[model samples]
Target: MDVDARLRELGLELPTPMTPAGNYVPAATVGDLVYLSGAGPLRPDGSMVVGKVGDGGLDLDAAREAARLTGLQLLAALRAEIGDLGRVRRVARIFGMVNCAPGFNRTPAVIDGCSDLMVEVLGDAGRGARSAVGMAELPFDIAVEIEAVVQVST
Candidate 1:
C-alpha cells in the first residue's frame, strides 16, 4: 500500500504543518536528504503539548504519546514539502529530546513512540538510529521534540 493508505490503516491523520517559531526552517533538503528541524508536540488545535517526562506533570507514558504525535506532525511536514510521502526513500535518523526530571529512566521507551510509528508507516526500512536525551527543558516545555533525516526520491 501507499503512504496515505498506510496511515489510514493505522488510523493516523497528519496535522497541519507548523511554521517555525524562530530563526529556522521547518525542513530543508540537501541533495536527496531532507533534514527536519525539531518539532515539538503540538495539539490538533495548533497548541503546544507541554510537560516534562518522569515528572508528575508528564511521565514516561505521556512522553511516549507526545513523541508519537510529534512524529505524525513531522510526516505531515514532509508531505507538505514533497507533495507525497511515497517520495521518501528511507529514514536516516531521528533526534528525540525529552524534557524530564533528573532521574528519568525511560527515554528510550518515550522515543519508541516515534520509532514505532515510523516502522508502522515505512516498515523496517524506516527504522533509524535515534538519540533520546533528557533535558531540563525543551522548546515550549513540551514533553518531546523530534527531528529527522530522511532520504528522498529524486
Candidate 2:
C-alpha cells in the first residue's frame, strides 16, 4: 500500500518535521543511506512527553507511546529529506535510548513501539537491526529517543 494510505489505515498522520534544537541537521545522506538524528517524543502541539521510565516516573506503557511518537518524528524527517517515503529502500538500523531510573530493563520492549510502526508502514523494508538501551537522562527528559539509518533510492 502507499505510505499515505497505510498511515490513514493506521489512524496516524505525520507531524511537521521538527527543526533542529542544536547545530546539527535533522537528517543527512551519504550514498544511499539517510541518517536521521535522534528525535524525541515531541508532539505536534510542541509539548514533549517528559519523564524517566521506571521508579517514580512514567511507566512502560507511557514510555512505549513516547517511543512511537519519536518514530513518527523520524518519519517526518525522512519525508522532509527525501520528499517521498516510497523512495525508501529499507530501514537499515535503529538505535533507541530510553531515559529511565535505576533498574529498568525493558528497553527493547519500549523501543518496539517504533519498530512496530515502521513495519506497519513499510512492510518488509521496515524490518531492521536495532539496539535499545537505557540512559540516565535524555534531552528534555523525554521518555524515549530514537535515531535511524534508512536506505533510499539514489
Mind giving the per-residue lDDT tens digits that candidate 1 earns over 85-116? 98888899999988889899788899999999
User: Candidate 2's residue-wise lDDT over 79-121, tens digit each?
Assistant: 9999889888999999999998999999999999999989999
* Clashes (candidate 1): 0
lDDT of 2 at 84: 88
The lDDT values for all models are 0.87, 0.93
Please state every model's RMSD to the true fold in angstroms.
Answer: 1.1, 0.9
Best by lDDT: 2
Give candidate 1's whole-model lDDT: 0.87
Clashing pairs in 2: none
